[model samples]
Target chain A: MGESILQLQQIRKSFDNTEVLKGIDLEAAQGEFITLLGASGCGKTTTLRIIAGLELPDSGQVILEGRDITDWEPNRRDVNTVFQNYALFPHMNVADNVGYGLKIRKVPKAEIERKVEQALRLVQLEEYGKRMPDQLSGGQKQRIAIARAVINEPKVLLLDEPLGALDLKLRRQMQLELKRLQKQLGITFIYITHDQEEAINMSDRIGVMHEGVLEQLGTPNEVYYQPRTSYVADFVGNANILHKNGETLAIRSENIRMDGESVCTLDAVVVEKSFAGGQLRILFRLADGQLLTASRYGIDNDIQPGETVKIGWDAKDAVKVIDNDKDENQR
Target chain B: MTKTKTKGNSRRRSGNIGLLIPMYVFTILFVALPILYLFLLSFLQRAQVWGVDFTFTLDNYKRILEPLYLDTFWQSLKLAFTATFFVALIGYPYGYFMARMSAVWKRRMLLLIMIPFWTSALIRLYGWIIVFRSNGVLDKILMGLHLTDQPLKLLYTYPAVVVGMVYSLLPFMILAVYSSAEKLDMSLVEASRDLGASSWTAFWTVSFRLTLPGLLSGVVLSFIPSMGLFFIADILGGNKIVLVGSVIQEQITKGRNQPFAAALSAVLMVLTSVMIRLYRKITGTSQLEGML
Candidate 1:
């Protein structure tokens, strides 16, 4: 296990009678890419802001590199944030904007320019130093933001959905670029995003947040295959839960095979069938009115709507969860 | 076919011209003609009786180069510049604070700023007279408090004129800076702090520069009007002071020296945009140093 670079302990924040964050405890190890994954308004961004010292939590402790930095102002923290909107200075040119932090620290003119050029080059934007932020495209702006944060060489770089505004293809490309940057720099990156794919692909481990609480924390495979709570299973992937005798059963859409290839098989009537690019989504109803969704590719099955079929899954693939006990306090 | 194509092009061109006709007519009627007339009047001789003598002469312009008149021009520039500086100094912070305020407070502050604007400006100036003149409200309050034995001469000073100008032109400066400050992305400030810039440094690098456009517009709005608002000097300074606006007013109504007055008006008009450009340059240089 890596040494913990940052630890957030029992962070609780509320705004105008609405508790945005309920007791979030998160940890990011050195050089680890940890993501706070949640939908919008779930306090993921707020948690990131708390770590960056942009927003003070109502009650919490932020320990960075074994030091309690909770009361420190944002500039005193050893962390930088790549804002969701990039927030690049529109008036200043790229070089000025990138070198602003160095200039503020009273670094020499030549040194500031050198570090700025180096950072820009790292983002593959050596020639864009003279361009204003508005002159650059979305992807270019995102890279500039990354370069801006990366140049500081902070202990942890917080990014709040840096690619949310970009198109799908550009976002995917930047995702890989971000991952490469994280590995190349070897600095801890605490990324916050609502997109499950982005969080799963870029982060070494993801912390799933729901209504301000840290629901679960694990690697993508662990969270996806063995979700400790129903929220994690539903949020991370397509999950169909079957409630039986107070013990909830969670089966991943892909895990529940259409044909009788597993030990547990149940006869079901196909209620709905929808084609989704590469896979076919089939909704089935059991004899007891339990709805289950099974995802199969074209070559895997030929299930159609209104067709009666048998859905089966091995016992190992089915994970049981207690929905009521997990969310009683949160609600 | 070629004739029809040419006709089509001409039709489009004519349609565009037709759409612009109202603007051109309004400009010609209200703006261009007055400027041309003013320019023509500046080059002519003042009549002994009334109006202007229709003769080409540099005498009117040459009269403005006199030492006494030149002093007035210098005084006008100084006063206008001072009032503008003060307006900007006070307005930027007020505007910045207002922009950062909550919605309810923002509306309340905006209303408070506009309250004096709703009443007639002439009326407002008169109200200032009631406060500043000897044995007036200010003197009465001071005397009541026993701060002074007599009326402390609050009325007829350079500071009085400046206060009046700032009072009148403050809304323009505040609103202009507010317009820019409100549109600013606050996250940039946070980003600056995250990048290791202190709160003060972030303000200079992010908030100040981002709001420069608004501040400059405020300067233009306040400075240009202050240069021309001679009534402030006349009323507040007890008619002891004379800026370019009063000089122009005196020339037209009392002195019957319209040509020289026209020349001064032309000078002030040209100076307006020039001052804006020069102020922008000065601020620009200051910002460049700050950036370094």
Candidate 2:
């Protein structure tokens, strides 16, 4: 939709003899918040590091704002990264840490002070300017890290699981805060995280990775509703995958209705049922002995573990995914 | 049940106290008592062959203020500081390189630093003597190569003494700085660089500041032993450079003034304690608990 601010063409990286990134090609539009989402060791962080110029790709081109910056060092690149640990300077107070970039550029003292105040206020940490990083809580430290990065006003902002260190509630809150900040700043953000919920909640586009390969890249809705591979389907959310010919048909647990009015109805015995907040998660074993999970809301009727129930879903809800074997072969 | 639980707790507390008493007794008997004795000995007059006729006097300390003994103390301090300064300057980069190296390289380089420790300090000083002597390998090679008309008098000099001390104490500095540098999280350095700081700026602002504790300890390690050690100066300095340690040795063996030697030893110990306290204050480090 806009000119590409950052582009990675066929980037490859390895540690020792093990390949970590296998020819990753990705592009981020101006003002886009793209997340590289995957499980651990899936090269999501490696890709983000490559984009930030922290790690050199074996063979690739990194173009930023239409300039080939593949060989640019991290300090030379107009990009800043917020590490998961925050990595705040333990010796420096909040204002000094935030203004470090400006000071490095030899900006005027008054300008640096003004910018630091503005940045601290942006992260709602105006009063924390005199405190050291160790004195701050995890959430406050994360916000300081964000303030430090945003103070630079780089063309691209790389985040390596910036919320991974926070507690669950704090992480959720930071997720909203980060999204809001991204929208307000409109800088291209290349975020890396293993948390699928975080990726789905904050990203304009989610690139799902599996074992150093990009499985699929799309909007969150597309990744959830129209997964291109079995790994993506299982990685993005809970899915009941059934093999049909060479392709795997994946149906979301919530899409499989229990009314038994659909064409593909199977007699299943309820194996387990869990009351999870507003929804009930019912695990079932079909006549073919295949396990399936289904979620139903506001269902007062209780189903015993051994009780037989007819489970069905419309054919339209079953998205076809390439079989694991086929996907591996393609790679 | 409550009585039994209380009894068990009291037994455990007594056991812990029992374990702690021996450590306290050992420390007091071997460490604290000797230091206290030395402090008192410094203020006493010399005894006449263990006759137990003692008088409190500051004569030994006053004698040290004379030019001959005073120069030795000043020289020892200057030499110790010089060695410590060079050790830090060289060791910081070496330690940084070691920290950034791969495991294999790090182990190999650490072994290079440690190999000297396995050998005796005297033997290492002997090795330096042989290398720096008038007709030793270094001089012979230089003369043979026609680099100079005569064999240079390098063996018995202040530079030779400084060089030997630096060689001996450099490993401690490197190891101390290396331990700190190895534990440093690389993300912080990257964060600094990402903020547009140059490599040198990042190193000074973040890397060096974080490793200050190690550097301070290393300085202390190098300074303390170098001050008290007269062997390197005795061997390489040709007995011309009289350090505080040489003065103490002279008072005991050559001068035959045991009480004065004891007084000098006490003064040196006090100086070391003061230096250590100052170092801890500056670096905000507690009394170093781990082996250097």
Candidate 1 backbone collisions, by pair: none
lDDT of each: 0.87, 0.87
Model 2 lDDT tens row, B208-228: 998888788888888999998
Off by over 4 Å in 1: A261-265, A299-303, A324-331, B1-20, B279-292
CAPRI quality of model 2: high
A271 Cα displacement, candidate 1 (Å): 0.9
> What's the distance in Å from true for residue B169, model 2?
1.6
Q: Write candidate 1's Cα lDDT for A233-252 as tens digits.
A: 88887688887676788898
- Cα DockQ of the candidate 1 complex: 0.77
For model 1, how does the per-residue alpha-carbon lDDT over B28-77 read when each residue is reduced to its tens digit? 99999999999998999988898889999988778888998899989998
